[model samples]
Target: MTDHGPQPVERQLPTEESRALISLVRDLTQREIAPTAAEEEDAGHFPREVFGLLSASGLLALPYAEEFGGGDQPYEVYLQVLEELAAARLTVGLGVSVHTLACHALAGYGTKEQRRTHLPAMLGGGLLGAYCLSEPAAGSDAAALRTRATRVGDTWTIEGTKAWTTHGGIADFYTVLARTGGEGPHGITAFLVPGDAPGLTAAPPERKMGMKGSPTAQLHFDGVEVADARRLGDEGQGFAIALSALDSGRLGIAACAVGVAQAALDQALSFTQERRQFGHPVADFQGLRFMLADMATQIEAGRALYLAAARLRDTGRPFAKQAAMAKLFCSDAAMRVTTDAVQLMGGYGYTADFPAERYMREAKALQIVEGTNQIQRMVVARHLAGPGGAP
Candidate 1:
């Protein structure tokens, strides 16, 4: 049999159904998502149609409840699916993850009536979502957010600017975190606002260093009115809800980082075998061979780290510390692996003609998203050494 490059990964799925699902996702990636990723990203365009297709195919809502039209798959299965999609294109994989995060507040904390009212359409009705939490002043220090939501009887008016929001302008709905009480974490609240609400506007998408196909922008909520029913959870409960979503969201970012690293390694491996150096294949060089080994090792270690964290979450355990570790390790490893992949190609990798440079650019954003590696270390240290105690 002819080797068509690196074969598909053999995933450890919980069921035959999950195995079939991965197979379908892989086929879809090869046939649909992979072809235009580079060109589309170069143009800084968002593929809303592809997202619509994934939603229609039920791929976008895999980790949520089947009762609300989700696939009800475990995080392990769902994250592996994310890895596969991300290998094809980071935009799709990360977008799905963010959409799931946006849905988390309502799914986990909303009233039954609220769930029944919105979950079906949000999960399966081809409606994409954006998560709004990071403000211009509150990127890492999320609790210090200054966006305020003022309530007058039954109506709430939100006024503030949220930065680095994924799918900011194009999302069908946004899950917003705004100050509704006094100060600190307990004073915050989350609201589900429609994207087209009056006085809500988005700046032009940011000219990012990577993941250009994914629209990231500043969202301005200027007297945006929402009914009291749109508030997620209770007063003083928003910060906890946001943290819960972030813990899960970090896993998604980790999985996507692994996928990008794997893709970079695969490209380097294939190119080394094909390109001739010193009158022999480049793969024949011991120096190049060792680099490939290290890249593969980093990818494996990252995959194992994220999967272990996912298993913990799937089994109803506290996995926050592990999630932070996975996010820290995997995203940093991606930056390392992609940078090495670019080096492997000598001068060719520096140009956009090959995908190495593109992968390198994309890996960078993962290190900053979800939370910075600095924040991840802080989280892990707090869990490990107690608050502010490290020897």
Candidate 2:
């Protein structure tokens, strides 16, 4: 594996502490992640130890409150750390994002007692988590999910399957949404399910195109019981909780997309400069130079867009529209930039010997996850217009 150390990204950190944090992350990524990323990914290995290290180092808890053993960093700082991690390895970066998403319900909506009991262990106790929302039949239409949870004397029994769950089988805990009433979003409720619960099992991981190291699988819940105390919010509020979590999760996807794009651009730059043509390095040619310029511009713009949205979130502002825009724009930008990176490298880019192909494959997944790019457009449109799209 070619250890192309951390590429220089001129970050606008708010504090010296954050700058030092980034420097620390870069050092960590260079030392631990980047070196074995390709080899482990190729072998379809999930780096659970790396996640353990992150939890031990407090990287896993950056955006949450310090009262619960979290890092107490703002979204702005937390997301930049995500960007740095993603630049090293998407499996690690997006895994942290999904873990954060899994913790969202309890952090944002759980009662004080719930936080006191569960938040600290979740945030920093070396536990991995998964978010369960999408099902096999209900991907885009999440409200139509068929997962049913029946209440009986202070206990809820969940029986259904959740699909496309990242870290599905390996997660220590799962944040699950199940229908408790009639139908649609209003009938749903959220629960924190222990991974070791009886009757809860996971299917084998999906054979994916990229991020092969990250396990995506279907989770089965057959009579999995939970205490009423584990309920996240009021009855029939799970859909709202899920949507709220998605808003922040989309920003995470945007940051990861930009990170992948930056990695591709770095590969293109390195390759073009080293591989020479007739008289000079291919990077010196006008056409390839122009391509590199465009790639860099797109990456910078995507970074700025995500950071802008992160700032809004950090400041307690209505940033849903901007979050959708950032997810859509940054993911689309990642697709284009990765494709261009491959093109600039010509035949070499298409081969497995280089990381460009892997980056391109990984970029494709970002457009589809956390709501597809088309769904993002609909979200942005709904924010701009009314529910019926009337401006």
Candidate 3:
């Protein structure tokens, strides 16, 4: 059976402008992104032009302030936009999310002068960004990162390697976290380093199972120097800034997870109805119908959970716990739903001839990125039962 793309998702946006914006995104995604997703992903080609288009179209800067070339959309609206893009292509969606995460340290914590000088181009000047926090030995335990930034006169010298950095080599700027003092979280500090900074290099991109279109590689900061003016927030406060950014980043991951699950469900629905079994459409069978039902239900639940957390963030409420919960639930649900989609498709699902297999592989990464589901659980538990688990 020939594949049609995913069915339209009904969204609950806050305003007419937001609805129009989503329509624009949907049109752009269909015309530019979805049509080439599978082919480019298979070829492992990073769509830098598409990202440049996204930046020029104002999709890349949706949730940030308008004063600095952002779209000034609320988190609630911006996240739904993410869901739609992700449903089209995870590389574009997650790349936008990581770019937004990279901007967080500056938009939320940088000095007014810093914002004016850098935020505009970074947001809309066709510049891609990456976040550098995790290191070779510090994945989930980011507070234990070993990258060092030593103050030398007015310039700080950064020296160490960062692992698993998305857009590692190609970004225009990097939000880097380095230890400026002793060990642990309190010693850390944040810096906005130019992508072409001296002594900064990226190893070859790591071969990945999925989302191969997006590069993930180790960044080597071999005595990369930064002026004091690029420092974000107070010294010894980088870990807190990273955590704050992650609280919002997790919501982006949640929205992307829901998008993948929805895509898988749509694929399964289309495939089963066209493929017949025993002289009847496979979708006519009760067993496959139940599977489709479960997949749809999970997608709906994940959509709701992530939107709820986004609303909480938009309303200026405490949403760290809810963000962690959404990330954990949605990623797990995506994994289950995508797996079931493959099962419902039978043997055809296991092959690259179908998108179900790709969706399933992509879903697996969501459970591990931003924060592993295990780390998300710990974040939620700490919020619920205190850090010491003393109720």
- What digit string (tens of lDDT, one per residue) describes model 3 on residues 1-391? 3556667888998899999999999999889999889989999999999999999999989999999999999999989988888989999999999999999999999999999999999999999999999998999989889999999888999999999999999999999999998987899999999999999999999999999999999999998999999999999999999999999999999999988888889899999999998999999999889989988988999889989999999999999999999999999999999999899988999998888999999999999999899999998889877898431
TM-score of each: 0.97, 0.98, 0.98
Q: Over the stretch 172-263, how does candidate 1's per-residue lDDT look in tens digits?
A: 99999999999899999989999999999999999998899999999998999999999999987999999999999999999999998888
lDDT of 3: 0.93
lDDT per residue, candidate 2, 1-391, as tens digits? 2535349798999999999999999999989999889889999999999999999999999999999999999999999999999999999999999999999999999999999999999999999999999999999899999999999999999999999999999999999999999888999999999999999999999999999999999999989999999999999999999999999999999999999999999988988888888989999999899999999999999999999999999999999999999999999999999999899989988988888899999999999999999999999988887577421
Query: lDDT score, residue 134, model 3?
Result: 91
Model 1 worst lDDT run, 10 consecutive residues: 1-10
How many residue pairs clash (N, CA or C atoms closer than 3 angstroms) in each of the candidate models, in the order given?
A: 0, 0, 0
Count: clashes, candidate 2: 0
Highest-lDDT candidate: 2
Candidate 3 similarity to native, TM-score: 0.98
For model 3, give the 10-residue run with minimal summed lDDT: 1-10
